[model samples]
Target: MIRRFRLAAVLIATTAVALPGCDRPPEEDTAARPPAPTQNADQPLELTTDSGAPLESRRGEWRDALRALLAAPDADTLATADRRWRDLYDAFNRHYLSLAAQACAGDRQAPLQRLDAWPLYPAYVDALPAWPDSGIVNDPALELSAASLRRQQGATADGEVALGFQPIRLLIAGAKGAPRQAKDLRAEGDEPAAALRERRRTYLKLAADQLQADLNALDRDDGLSLTSLRCALETLDDRLAALQTHRQATAPEEGLYIPSVSVEILEETQPKAALTQLSADANRDARAALESGYPGFQTALDQAVEEDSWAPLGEWLHAHGD
Candidate 1:
């Protein structure tokens, strides 16, 4: 019953207030039907605010804020800004729905707690190979509180054992099949299904060996709990196993053809050159705003504010010092 898109918006409560017919009291409002469709149902739904303001319709004036942040002069500042913007966008785009799920499941401080718990998750997501599209399989933030609780309870060994299996989840999610219908594509070249089966086996074996090695070394020294690292590694192996089983069972006679998932990965990974510019601009604007009320930097600052550019600024200051 939780609304995915509605909960995902930044400052959703403000927009919620602006929504027409939202004032009917919680009981009645919860029963109210959604607003009438402005566009054809055949097309992707055009996102809008509660007041019927268009969101995904046109790029809007807010995009310029992103542009300004990316246009900043300092390379370091820009890099910092880029990371910040990237994290903000990633969090907003990737986990919004997932977060809603958690909140609905009854974690009140779910979002903030996540931010505190797994600081490395966003970076991990950015670095992950984008096969089958981008997403965190089990967002570290979601597990942060529970994981921390285990640590606090002195379940370090047990926790590591569980953590070792986490990567398998990613492997499964990244599989070419699943909710996505990539397996429907036909494999090309003269290689028969038998050959592909062998190849798949080889790939799975190699992946498993690497994963085992990874798991065995969990928590040797990396300050990371042996449990957490192993969870990720084991998860990867289990997913590989599942993928192999699925492929062997359902693989086409022509072999399992996924129209080059690497391309999708690469596309997802394309870096934003504008981030550096945006970051520098944001800082320059923020400083200028402080000195003279932000006329010079207002546009850029607004972008930073809109897209949550403060992340990169903080990172930049941390790396650069003072």
Candidate 2:
């Protein structure tokens, strides 16, 4: 089970393998052991139990896994943390769907709780910046989720208004990270509250631990989180070139990287790929941000480009920041 108060693991995953582009110490060259399988860009990248496992930063498997995911797209390789997360959700969906059928027994909305209506909703919400509280914990399935988080953290009834990482991650990993499906709350009528509450605790221990472990990888030194910056950079490039047409996305940690990178990156974070989505002022700001932030990374990216492989980006991140 996840112990919420547990100290985060500080070490990166260890490995005996070595990658070609990166130049680091013997102990630091923790590449994926057998090399990741190729992934197909056009396919919906299927995830199995092996692809969604949790990780410790010290062991650094998460880093290895991340490199694998980014490096190969027609290959079926997965990082430890990614695999663990997907597996957890695959299991949760089965359990959650079953609970929903029971909760709704007859109606599709037997049990629902609107957390935003609670008097202490504001304070309850401020506590979880990671989750975008929908303000409503609909159906017995979500009600149980909120209750579990509250009990684990020893929070008040008002706190039971929101779901935590365990639930949130399930949503992110599924449906391409789209908004939660519209649940039927108008059909609310009857449900077994006691049984549902009990059921919520069944996977609480496992789910909590998994969520915490992944959280550690992401919060401490996650390659997935860092990779977002790379993706965002590509988006920034497209947006700047067209000025009148491209869309712009803020790099991961755009604000944090302001002093280290460029302020224009955040100057225009809105996506404006087409003319319909364009804004003259915003585009100008985005262009400026590209100029500002591009300098710091370009020197490194240029170095990598001349080498003809993207591998140097990882080495640069190692020397600079995530």
Off by over 4 Å in 1: 1-191, 222-314, 317-319
lDDT of residue 48 for candidate 1: 13
lDDT of 2 by residue, 1-322 (tens): 2212111122112111111111112234334211212322112111111112222332254335434433442224422434544443333222221222222222212121110011122212211233333222322333334355445331433222233332332222211222212121112234643443233233333334444443332222121111222233332232233222211211211110001011222222222111111123433433233324333444545555566443444344334322
**Best candidate (score: lDDT):** 2
Query: What is the TM-score (0 to 1) of candidate 1?
Result: 0.19
lDDT of 2: 0.28
Considering every candidate listed, which one attains the maximal TM-score? 2
Expressed as tens digits, the lDDT of each residue in 86-198 for candidate 1 is: 33333222222222222222222222122212101111221123222222222223222333322321122111111111222212122333321112111333655334323
Per model, state how many residue pairs clash: 26, 28
